[model samples]
Target chain A: MKSIITEPMIPKPFRIHRKLKETHDTYTIELESTNGADGFPFSAGQFNMLYIFGVGEVPISISSDPSMPKMLKHTARSVGTVTKALLNLRRGDILGVRGPFGSHWPVEEAVGNDVVIVAGGIGLAPMRPVLYSFISHRDKYGKIILLYGARTPEDLLYKKELELWRGRFDLEVKVIVDSASGNWRGNVGVVTTLIPRIQFDPLHTVAMICGPEVMMRYTLKELQNCGIKNENIFVSMERNMKCGICLCGHCQFGPKFVCKDGPVFCYDHIKELFGKREI
Target chain B: MNIAILECDHLQILLDVLRKRGYQVIGPTLGEGAIVYSDLNSTANLPIGWTDEQDGGTYRLKKRNDKALFGYTVGPHSWKKYLLPSELRLWKIKRNGVSFQIVTENEATRKFAFVGVRSCDIHAISVQDKVFMNGQYIDQHYTSQRKDTFIVAVNCGKAGGTCFCVSMNTGPKATFGFDLAMTEIIEGKNHYFLVETGTELGAEIFREIPHKQANEKEKCAADDILRKTAEQMGRSMDTSNIKDLFYRNHEHPRWNNVAERCLTCANCTMVCPTCFCTTVEDVTDLMSEHAERWRKLDSCFTMDFSYIHGGSVRASTKSRYRHWITHKLATWIDQFGTSGCVGCGRCITWCPVAIDITEEVHAIRESETVIGKQKTIVKEDIHANTGTLSGRTSFFKRP
Candidate 1:
């Protein structure tokens, strides 16, 4: 038992400044680091391992854009025990933040091309940064098309931002639901329906999609059918990310680490992983 | 490099010398119903005349004709039992009311000199090194245990029934990762160890020991014996295109076929030296004020390992087995830059069912085309490209 001492892993404290309920089960938490006034930096589509005092830790994506560095926002749905505990936290509660891990949307790569943003349910969280990046640099791209779908009208997230984007002529926003009530006046079909409505030159277009595996897979097929090359389409995948770094074997999808290699990957890079189940 | 010959009579004296030099010499000793690694003070404590006959789920010690100290290839246990301990306390947390402060225990400090390390064990250590140390998140516990350890590697004089180190390109002769390597050459009245120094410390040890320089005849004998052991390997895996095979055959029925027999007892993981999956647990006292955080080794074979919202992602045994096998043989190349398995054969020997990895690969290869037929039926209506969300989107909305 040789004692080879190295650097100690210290947990940094972050205070929950605000909480917003986007939907019934989903909530957005805005946190500020207690250690330094300078908040933790994170790109959209990257996640942080949030640790609760009594409960354990879980990986949650940073939903806010990189421009807002002072406050970190994580839009998470209450899925498991750890997330349930996280949603119970009121304003001014303390939590541990580990990383702003994984690759972000290639906004720089899609600078001069038609950018098509597709999101389903809570999947919109990871794409929020890329959306903001596009808005700030609106003149950089050609056509900006956003196709977002939720389970229901009530399940739709970022309604305020969606409303704001609807007023912009540079952006085209189409919102759909899987199932709708009698009072629902929006599109009443799958997200794939909206893909045909957006007109863009496929060869000069770069699409970024984030959603349920089923939804993303279908959307990817639609994008390909519409002439979007595999390399031009980027997708963010989900996995059980224990360690945000590449060590823990949980987030492994084939050779790629969803936490490190991607939460964002070219469709060509992970086309094989999408072929298999529980990769 | 130097070679030294130590007689069987002077073995205890050599052990004592090593012990006096501040080395916690650990070797085979009788412990817990089998020969296991333990602190040894003398040569008499070694399993001198003991050899093991090992197979799937069966291991028994048998008496050998020669009184050889290092005759056995390997047992169920490897050096990893100590280096990457089965159970470890990662961190402790104490709560005073609502506020909790985590107190980490200082890691143990002591220099260890493992005496009878086999080549496969060295490979196992290297495999674990890639997982624990070479990554962005270094495992402090494994790093601490491995840093100051000295190794005395022993070349295999005999091959076990479950041995396949040769096929994995790991064994028969100690290649690297050891301070010193020894080959025991005992013919008739001649009983001595031909020791070779691999490191400066090993050269220092060689300087202390009395021995004659090895001639060409002795070197040839050592080489011949190692070659013989390599040829005598009990199993061999066709590693060529193994990653590709697993990647391409995702729908292979062999997974489901093997899953029926696999009990998911996790014995394979327990014996595997490189399996480093862990789950964190939080324990609270009756008072509820005191809590402790423990990190325990976990296996993908368990249903709870893939637990997400509502249920487990891999609820069936077939999926779990597929995850482990693919991750080890195929996806590991992408993650760790090498295969996860070192071909130690401990997983094969320890598994309750004789689920040999070599056989499983062959089974998948042979049934690939037939498996494709089953795939068509198994394919959900969800477009192959999109996955399984075909007509279900409309049902997601509630009244």
Candidate 2:
């Protein structure tokens, strides 16, 4: 028997270029190839398998700008062991990175149409790149709007970037917090309440949403109520993924392998399965 | 050269020939009431004149009137155990200063000769080849084990109660993917093996077996036995546009009915030859100085199989059962360009509750036949009375 060595599961070494805390529990870590290799290119909603030595791996979305291919950025919450190990890393620390996998948000398909960005809490991380693409190419898309909701003021991510994006008159950004604590003056309700305050031509709008399943469900209903066609709405799905490729069968959502077929799927394609429980 | 005939008592010569070539010959042996595949050095280990009666949730061994070897359809054991093993170490990682270096295990060099392999199992192995070998990333372990193995396929002379390879287009006879193909011929007082070489290695091995040319009458008897086996298939599934059948009926009510009966024991996936899902775990000693990542067979029925950070995706047995059946008959064709099930019937016979996949498909198709009239009634009842939360509460109430 001839043994052929294959290491598709092995991760490549990537060094931390910088680390910045987004929220109290979330951190945005910038990474680059340790050997000065070419940077891993990825789309907005696609994810990378971040591997922590002696720990394990987790799928984190590439939250960095797609145009700048030299540096890779991932926003991770200290939710589990692997994410905790990643959060503990200092500058120049080495970790393994595999992929740039799954389907991306249809940013190109949304061109020439008004795009509605709705995100909840840490769910905003995957949508941050899509906002970057729309802001950089300001004229390609029509009235860009973002409606972000958080559990508390402290949970809001990319604070400085949100402030800078708000300064622009071309795009509209609305922020809401679930409950008030210290001089909280914004809207005090779920993300679905903020959808009515924003206005866009729903007929020509492409809505992209990412959040908890229940939150996404309520937000989807609100978007459809605003005359947004089911075909125009896209939602990012979450499932346990072992292999970013379609081999492991862990991330299967019906006929689709969320790791391969999609993390971002159009509403029409998955309308039958969106609110499905235990599936 | 031409087809050869081996007398019933001269089967020991072939075992000796394989052993002389440094091959560990494996064949069916009577063990603890069941015929299982194990090491066979002589014909005494063979389950001669023994046949098995199999049905959904039932199996029994019975002595046959004719003294013919390899008369049974298939046992609980498939050829997958020899190829894609249950557990294997993917790689060993040792902490080297700051970074770790991974050292892959050396390939297993033990050459194997698997005798009495059924045709459905050979097709099942080929289906796995499409998954492990023909894919972009080849499974190194499966590749090495497959390359060194020799197949001696035995054409079925009798079909079990659960045999259904004829419907899946796999076979009751060995069509290809074998080094040597044999048919057990029992006519009156004569019992012999019609051995046909499928490859150069098989031809060379046949030359050393001291066999004589099979005449026309012997060849006719061999073909006649396979013909009878095909006619006696106990179960069959309609594969005509089977992929679309499951796709259109993903939310059919039959899934809930089956889920009520399912225990989620995962016996079906364990016995299925084509269900190749797996998971990896990192194990270390108490001191935690060294860790080894081992890959083991996993079943889709387990809640941990679909678990992500927050919770399991397929938390309900209905969803897991739906995923298993749909993936086997429907979506598997989209992913691998072939059906995941080879209709081996291991799933049917081994399932504790006797949940037959063929029966499930028939139920779905029949439900769909009357779906136009029953659509509004089923939809309203599902939403008004049996919503997911209420339905889940009732599903778990089952004892």
- Candidate 1 lDDT by residue in tens digits, B36-111: 8899888888998888888877778888999899988666677777776666665666654444567776766567
Candidate 1 CAPRI grade: acceptable
Indicate the TM-score of model 1. 0.90
* TM-scores for candidates 1 onward, in order: 0.90, 0.88
List pairs with backbone clashes in candidate 2: none
Fnat for every candidate: 0.34, 0.36
Across A1-279, the per-residue lDDT of candidate 1 in tens digits comes to 223224223345688889999999999999987765785677767888888875878888888878888889999999888999999998988777777777888898998999999999998888888899899999999999999999999999999999999889889999999998999999989999999988999999999999888888899999999999999999988777666666556766778878778989998888877856765
After superposition, which runs of candidate 2 have C-alpha atoms over 4 Å from their true positions? A1-6, A88-93, A201-204, A224-232, B1-3, B8-24, B109-111, B199-208, B368-399
Model 2's DockQ score: 0.30
lDDT of each: 0.80, 0.85
Q: How many backbone clashes does candidate 2 have?
A: 0
Each prediction's DockQ?
0.23, 0.30
Candidate 2 CAPRI level: acceptable
